[model samples]
Target chain A: AQSVTQLDSQVPVFEEAPVELRCNYSSSVSVYLFWYVQYPNQGLQLLLKYLSGSTLVKGINGFEAEFNKSQTSFHLRKPSVHISDTAEYFCAVSDYGSGNTGKLIFGQGTTLQVKP
Target chain B: DTAVSQTPKYLVTQMGNDKSIKCEQNLGHDTMYWYKQDSKKFLKIMFSYNNKELIINETVPNRFSPKSPDKAHLNLHINSLELGDSAVYFCASSQRTGNEKLFFGSGTQLSVL
Candidate 1:
């Protein structure tokens, strides 16, 4: 079974400050990693994903994440945050071996709070 | 235009009632999925379809069923809804294969009273 763990449940940051949301996963085979953002009362929006080729992946709204195979981690980061960046972020994984069903397993989620 | 859309953004019904949530995607993707977000904000995959064929059906109760008329549309029907059935259901779609990112609909907030 594949599972994702988001170390922090909530993160509070000041506007224009840098932030990082930690995510780690455990899976027997290869997997695809993703970050999704959910605004207030809205569905999840794909922020970015790591399939292969590069360790660092860039996403919308100046967000980026790096995949560390050895560490089994995919941590999202931003150099600076804005009030609009505040939202719930989820880390998900899909095992490459599950074929088409490879349903995504999401973490508990981290709520980003940006204060002005 | 919205890549994915679900009807009845908010659903409020009495217990033991039945309801259905409709979802349509115009992204021309061949894969669709249904997910449930509980009150605690834990997102769980309920079903998945590829080319209108069932691909994944989690351990969801028999009370929940999904229908996909075509590759672009996947609908969810709930039977004899209970208070525990209240949740936010999201419809998502992605390309058939290879590193694809899912596009999700606004979601249907079902509240069983």
Candidate 2:
């Protein structure tokens, strides 16, 4: 079984400040990583995904994440956040196998509250 | 145009009532899934269907049933609704091969009183 852990539930940061949301995963086999953002009462939208190739993956909305194989972590970071960036973020992982069904295992969401 | 659409975006019903939420995806994908988000905003996969064949069924209660008539439509029916069943249910779809990023619907917020 594969699972994802989002260490923080709520994070508060001032406008224009940098922030980071931590994510870690555990799987018996290789897996794919993705970040999704959810606005208030809205559906989840894909922020970015790490399939193969590079370790540093850039996503929409000025967000980026690093895929660290040694630590089994995919932490999301933003250089500067605005008030409009306040939203809930989720980290998900899917196994990399044929006929995987593409079912994603998601972590408890992390709410980013950007203050002015 | 809505890639994924779900009907009755907000549903409020009394306990013991039965309800159904319909979902349709126009992305021409062969796989669909249902996920539940609780009051605490924790997402859990309930079921998955690829080509209208059941592929993944989680440890969800039997009260919840998912039906897919074709590759583009998947619907969920619930029986004997309980207060614990109140949550936001999301419908998503993806291509069965190469590209696997899921496209999600706005969600149906079910409130069982």
Error of 1 at B24 (Å): 0.6
Show the lowest summed lDDT stretch of 10 residues, model 1 chain A: A94-103
Q: List DockQ, one per candidate, in order.
A: 0.65, 0.66
Q: Model 1: runs farther than 4 Å from truth?
A: A98-100, B97-99
lDDT of candidate 1 over A2-54, digit per residue (tens): 89999999999999999999999999999999999999988899999999999
Interface RMSD of 2: 1.8
| Runs in model 2 lying further than 4 Å from the true structure | B97-99
Question: Per-residue CA lDDT of candidate 2, range B15-44, in tens?
Answer: 999999999999999899899999999999
Please count the clashing residue pairs in each candidate, in the order shown.
0, 0
Question: What DockQ would candidate 1 receive versus the native complex?
Answer: 0.65
lDDT of 2 by residue, A1-116 (tens): 88899999999999999999999999988899999999997899999999999999999999999999999999999999999999999999998777666779999999999999
lDDT over C-alpha atoms for residue B99 of model 1: 47
The TM-score values for the models, in the order shown, are 0.97, 0.97
